[model samples]
Target chain A: MDKKKNISMAVIKRLPKYQRYLREMLNNDIDRISSKELSEKIGFTASQIRQDLNCFGDFGQQGYGYNVADLYKEICNILGLTKQYKTIIIGAGNIGQAIANYTNFQKMNFDLVGIFDTNPKLCGLKINDIEIRDIDLLGEFLKENNVDIAIICVPSRSAQGICDMVVKGGIKGIWNFAPIDLSIPKEVIVENVHLSESLLTLSCLMNGAI
Target chain B: MDKKKNISMAVIKRLPKYQRYLREMLNNDIDRISSKELSEKIGFTASQIRQDLNCFGDFGQQGYGYNVADLYKEICNILGLTKQYKTIIIGAGNIGQAIANYTNFQKMNFDLVGIFDTNPKLCGLKINDIEIRDIDLLGEFLKENNVDIAIICVPSRSAQGICDMVVKGGIKGIWNFAPIDLSIPKEVIVENVHLSESLLTLSCLMNGAI
Candidate 1:
């Protein structure tokens, strides 16, 4: 656990993919897998997997591979999935509503505690049993709820402002779906789901421009 | 244009961001910007910006800086935005419906032509005026239409099958929302929006595990 703080961003990014594959393996009753086999399945090099896993602690034995269930649990712990996260969506727009309707995040322990939108028509509606409140009440709601993450699905122009509010309300993480980048304090972690950028990347690749 | 074919993936990823910032500048009535000024706005080093732009062609003057509109147009061309793409969603689930409702993609010229779902209840329902079609009819519909992109929003178990069908139907690009890595032919381009992995990334960062 002490070694986790120094783990590289590349390894950090790969952890979720590892977690995913491991979870699937667990579901399929795959009890153990050698590094090479796991690598073949994940498309990562065996040495790379060993090195990444080593950053945290020893897992796999020399001849005996890793135990799938054990690795999945450890990866989940590393991903902070051992504890439930209380989250709120700051926009009740298309993306926000969809996220609110998504049961997968809830299954992964991300609880949607509230939803907020500036539009009056959207304010009173409920999605996944969570009501969409007026944006004006967002600050107060944040103060009342122990929200660990804020899902910003609002328009780009309003994203930064919403981000500021969430940060002020003590949000530690932000899942931003907006196009614009939000400037926040050093402690706040941001994960962007930039749809337009992703689409452009596909188009650029399809165009054979890279 | 030939140089674009050899551009690195790192630079290709950065092009969308440059396009976005330039478009914002254009919206603000900013006609031109020096690399230094752009670097300050975009958070990239001026030298990096100059180098990335130099991949396609010479656009910025030695002293006068880059013309915003012209640079935006060039970047769009490089991103294949000069031509419109017909897109279809292969699942009418939460994410699929949200993408269909998103008008921004249409503004960017990714026209959502059809939506498909295995669920009988979802079929024939309309989203953004495009009626959702039965999955059974997807193959025939693809043959009849010129679809440039297939947005896969199905569950992991069904993703690969849907991918195979779309590839057979001649899709050049895939925007996958499922949490599975798709196997595709070399000519096909795939861009994934793995929300679960992204959320885990945020949690890991917030957990200080990396």
Candidate 2:
């Protein structure tokens, strides 16, 4: 396998799709898949899939395609899913609660270590057996725990402050569901999940605007 | 203004980012912004921003910056957010309940008209004054209501079946939160909100793999 160096954002975006389809194929008992067949299934061109996968290494041949199990495992390794990642969610609101209840993460070894909220009423509440702690102790919590990712589910008004706290608290990666755009250092990566964007995309599709 | 024929998916994906940054600029009393300024704020190249925005129309010029409020409203119109869209939520679990409680949608004119669940225990349960309805009656409910978008918050196992029901029930645009990708007709747009993908992206970033 080749080491990935400065991969394009476009290629990075396709990794999860590859992972998802490969897992589906594995579940269906399909052991091998061709670039042509993958293109048909995913609607991407055969060459596009080949180019995206080639960034990691030359695993699949010209005609033989790729072995399902091997490709899935490789993609898992590339995605850092091969190891358990300890995760925490800040702001246990609806979005936070939904994310906290997402068992897929736990199933994939992305453990939910802590859940915190600024709402005083929710400080002592519990979800999925993980008690909601006070946001004030987040820095202390991060100082003590080995949290790999911080999930921000706060509102637009408080998201930036909470994000600053998160960065100051030593979390390097942020999965932000806040409506605002967060500025961070180049070393830290912020993945923004804009719910409105999806809705608007659907709206644009429905209206034949795009 | 261009009619936007065959606008690339790359450009479509950036529309929300443009909309978002413009909204933030408006909030901060920054009324005008050039492509270069937008690029500095969003981390996208100036030419890329110019190209993305030009796909919609000649909003920005060589020397003059675009007006924030006007640009935002124009993008909103382009995104089909100017009109109110009635929406429905299937599978009133944590995800569905959370979406129903998201007032941000209401702020954007995407109104929540119905929330449904297969679980009888949750039928009469209320969130934000809207009671959950029976999933069996979704077809009838859709037939009577003007639901423009159907939000699928079901699990992976039942997501496809609910997707089929939603499509058959008459809603065209679907915002799916299910872990699985649903197969639908070509005309019907199904946007899958894969929370795991985001987490995995962070995982990859955290691992220094991507």
Candidate 3:
């Protein structure tokens, strides 16, 4: 049985939060936790945590709740984060560099393998010791290096062109920071992170509405 | 009588995409459109469009489609985009500067009124002519500038402190780029943009199993 069928994307996204709280509990030697206690720690309702966890096989007893270490391993297995993922950033600009320098990526499963930028002047520049290569050599680099994922941080105008190159280079998934909407083939999965959209959502919330 | 009563956060997040497609159609002089047409353009199902729009009201006829302009106005009203939001950013780092340089924020109904950073060297620096102010002046700046929304692009270690300051300064909403889990008082609302989480999800998809 494949691991993907047991959980949805929404559930997968929440696993990290669950893991964090569980890890803290484990470190503190809190072996057992009720759904209510887990809920309070992770900010989800007790019922929601149970339902989300119930999607997988039964892990918790009726009255005693879940064991911290056991629950952590279950969630980690579901999220596929037990193993590390080799990742490469495509653009070494402000956004790209910030992503490269971010410590969370390292703490998470991602291992930064390489960074690429279009500008010749930026070639050989190191962000946290990861050297930048010219974008022109992307195909050869992908072949030589086992880069399975690409983070697209290029400008909107150049996003599609770079996406095309990345797709051809056989990268399967992309985290797109470009503002424009991209259409990739069905085989390639693209997630658009429009920072402006997120900011606007916060603005709407401030206005006391949705 | 309020827009908040009918829409969920998930539905609200999709409004920008709908508005983008509606604007494109309006520019092309597309006067009338069905939920099906809108769905096809935005890659959502027609039933979802109808269901999401139905929450606001029946804007379309039973058989015929919807008037593009009318639907646009309805979505904008529901999203509270008809009113402008006075926004500010904290931390003038790479992420902060990139966000300030982004032109799309101005295109939306939100305006970047000010920026605050603790770095003495960055206090006088400007991006898009918005000067970075000393973080010590945050409380006064929020009050005097009528700033309602804040973007926190500071380091993870400093995120909680800045969030506390923003809340105390009377800012109602926060868009947090830092990966730390925050605990805010009941009145303050926060949206965490976990960048590495996005990267990890992309990695899972690339591996063909999560």
Candidate 4:
């Protein structure tokens, strides 16, 4: 874990995909896999896979390959999946409500402790039995609960304001769904799911690739 | 457009972000901007901005910079936003319904023509005036409608099957929200919005960066 100090973001971004493929293999009773075989399955080249795994620590043997279960656990550890994170969604709009109903996140150790929205009508409504709280109560709720991640499902205009409030209340991670790229302090981690940008990327590629 | 032949996927992905910032400038009544100034706003280095824009065509002048409106229009053209795309949602689940109700995509020229789900009860329900049809009707629907993009919001197990149907129906672009990476033909473009992988990336970074 100490060897992970300065790993490039490109390598880090690929870790989850690696972990995902390993989980599938593990489910299928695969005990071990060579980098070349994993490469074919995961789409990364053999040498690339080896280099990415090496960023964390020495893994695999001369010809024996990586132990599937061991690698899966190791990657999960690196990804902090062993620990539970209390998360709250701000702005219980369509996307926010959808995420709240996405109980898979809860199974993955990201517990949705609260949901907040500015709309008064939505404040008492429940999604997955979790009551949507008023946005005004977000700061107070944050003070009482040890929340780890703030899922910003608000619109672009209100995203930064909610982000500032959450950061001030001691949130460290943000899973932002808003179109706007948030301004945050260095210590805070923000992962954006810019739907429009992603869709545009698809269109751009499809247009040119054709 | 001839210069776009060999542009890297990395540059193509950044085009949306560049367009987004340029649009903000346009809305603010900014007629023009220098590369350096644009870089400061967009978070890309000035040289990087110049190089990315150069992949399409000559953009900013040496001393005069660029016309924001012209750059925005050029990016839109390159991104294929100038053309209208008929899109359909496969799987009327939470994410699917959210996307169907998302009028923003409609405003962007990606019109949602139809939605299909396997659940019998969900069929005939309307979202944004578009009725959800049975999954069995997807192939037929595609044949009748000139759908350019298929948004697959189905589960992992069903995504590939749905993807095969859409591709066979002449869908050139796919906005896949399913966690599993779909196996698609080279002629088709599939952009993924893997939510689980994204959340893991955030948690992984939060762990390491701290």
Candidate 5:
């Protein structure tokens, strides 16, 4: 963990987008790509691409460009996606089921190992071979299964409580889909996916003079 | 439209967070608030808050602080949430359904008017009193109804096609939840919500020294 090498979390968030573009380029047999080319394809500026990639290390030649395969591997290692992560999604509702059924997460090194919900009617139900377990078993199951990440798909009111339980159950990373923000310990990391904010952004763009 | 304002979309995205806090203060009957106090509560610096708000107008006093109600109403107006916007969601899947069922959108002056899905099996389905109609009806629906915002919640493979159709159907604003980024015309506004990017950010926060 090189503190000096700490990239902006904002930049890190776009690694997957870069990865997706690189994958497509690779599939299309594109061996090398310039910052300008990548930027044009990805809707970012050429300088932004260079600045973000330079944070890790020099992966590009002076006049030439970045080797598609090499840059892909470097980004993968930097994003901690070189290996699969054991993940569990809590709340077997619509959003939770979507996570369970999502195929892209499989490509991105997240393995949905289990799902938990307090709804008795939903317990024992299976979505694509993954059974929905009772929330009562979350603590023991997380410990036993050594789950590293837990995605909270519960309602806003239940988010903080579930986050506390997940952290206490030894899961430090959480991807929250709830509208409310959670206050976790310094050791725990919570990322909020506020759908409303995204909608509001679209609304502004619609209403703006642009 | 205040072209001089030129606030970054990122800063605009955080206005809702500030509004949320201001609403809390109003609920608690806190009549006045300084930039420092608001910053401390929201994890932003006082200068950042001042700058973000200053893009709209100066509501702060020299010695005292901002009037809570006045600032709140000003921020709301700046966000264009003073007028209600009719939003229709396409693809009645888990994420779409979740957006329909979400209560905060209505609270934020967005009305979830309609839901569309191409799946014949899901036609005429209802979520939270809103009916899910056939995708073929989107054009007439948009013309008939007052829907100004269209949310694309379909699969990644189908997202681009739906976006094209929606744009042709007279939708100027799109909130795309699919993983892939669509190339929309300059006349149309498209905001993407990538779940994988959010997950990767959480992973980095958990693993990196930051």
Candidate 6:
């Protein structure tokens, strides 16, 4: 893709917030929304909202504003939510098993295809109908199955090795729960899910820093 | 705090990123970091970093930069993390239990005081030295002991009720793991940990939207 067509990360980051608001509107049966109304609800300025939406295409009109469903669908398409991504969890620990049980992922079109664990006892265990497989089979499994994302639930020390293995197996994206940064190729995207960061943000706010 | 002293949310949001990089530098035995070096490591501009740090207090000098350990400690102090926050997990399900097992919180000084679940069977189960208690005692527990933060880890359907109960119990901050936006009182601060948003972010980037 050309540089002009490559959406800015700032705008890309706002997409999820817009999507969340749109999802709420869709649920409430609010079929349409003006940039002003969206700004009121989401705290972004109308002009900023308009500019961000305009980056994608002409979704808004002069008087009718944006059709909530259509805008939501467009956002889903842009975010790849319309496509089903086959995913695997690298660890069968609490964090891994918890993610396996998260239904929101399925709603977002992330299909959990498999779960892998190093422990032999956990291998045969079932979590939300998916049985955990031995970590030994992860390489062969990735080689055979169409796995798009690798959810790293392992601890910090083991996370890099898992990332290397997953990337080597041709996985394109990583959803890392590990607290460490993973060094991967530019072609392979990694999203680090650090829960403590959010807590720290809240902590700072509560500490009168905000 | 007055308007001039009230840090913007944008700056507040960047605190965790700065803290993460600061922690990394300290770990590497890097004693000091210039704004230029920090900007390179954390992707923020040098001036932006300087402004953010200046919002709190003077940390940088003319030639010598910020002392890594002191700055890290300052960040911890600003984040209210230097003080131990008595925390409770509201659900003993997969997410809650997993969070109870998370070692990162203790390192950040958020002590997990108790674990509570509505299900009677889960009560008394131990997760990392903290035994799960009946959800019924959450009110009395909060009344008797000090709880600075309440982690809402129940399902979306039950998250609101739990939030209301926790807020009514006189907690200050919430670390919500549920997939719902909670309607909370103005006094209560919430940091919604929506894992799916992060997933969608990665999805968009992978879809070449970024």
TM-score per prediction, in order, is 0.96, 0.94, 0.89, 0.98, 0.92, 0.89
Best by DockQ: 1
lDDT of 5 at A166: 90
List, residue by residue over B1-210, the lDDT tens digit for candidate 4.
556688888888898999899999999999989989988898999999988888867778888999888889989998999999999999888899889878999999998898999999999889999999999998898899899999999989999999999999999999999998889999999999999989999999888742
Task: Kindly report which residue pairs in candidate 1 clash with one another.
Answer: none
The clash number for model 3 is: 0
lDDT against the true structure, each candidate: 0.92, 0.85, 0.80, 0.91, 0.83, 0.88
DockQ, each predicted model: 0.77, 0.73, 0.49, 0.70, 0.53, 0.63
| DockQ-based class of model 1 | medium
TM-score for chain B considered on its own, for each of the candidates: 0.97, 0.94, 0.93, 0.97, 0.93, 0.92
TM-score of 3: 0.89
lDDT tens readout by residue for model 6, B57-155:
789997999998999988888788767788999998888988988888887888889999989888988999898999888899999987999999988
Name the 10 consecutive residues with the lowest summed lDDT in model 3 chain A.
A201-210
Indicate the residue-level lDDT of A152 in model 4.
96
lDDT of 5 by residue, B40-103 (tens): 8888899988888777777889779888999998876766777787888998887788778877
Candidate 3 ranges with C-alpha deviation above 4 Å = A1-6, A27-29, A120-124, B2-4, B62-64, B206-210
Please estimate how well model 1 matches the true structure, expressed as its whole-model Cα lDDT. Answer: 0.92
Better model by lDDT: candidate 4 vs candidate 6: 4
| lDDT for position A79 in model 4 | 91
Candidate 1: C-alpha RMSD after superposition: 1.7
lDDT of 3 by residue, B1-210 (tens): 565476788887887778778878999999999888888788889999988887777788877898889998887775568887778889888788877877667778678989889999999988888888999988888677767778899988799998888888888788898877888998887877887566656655555544
Output the number of the TM-score-best candidate: 4
Clashing pairs in 3: none
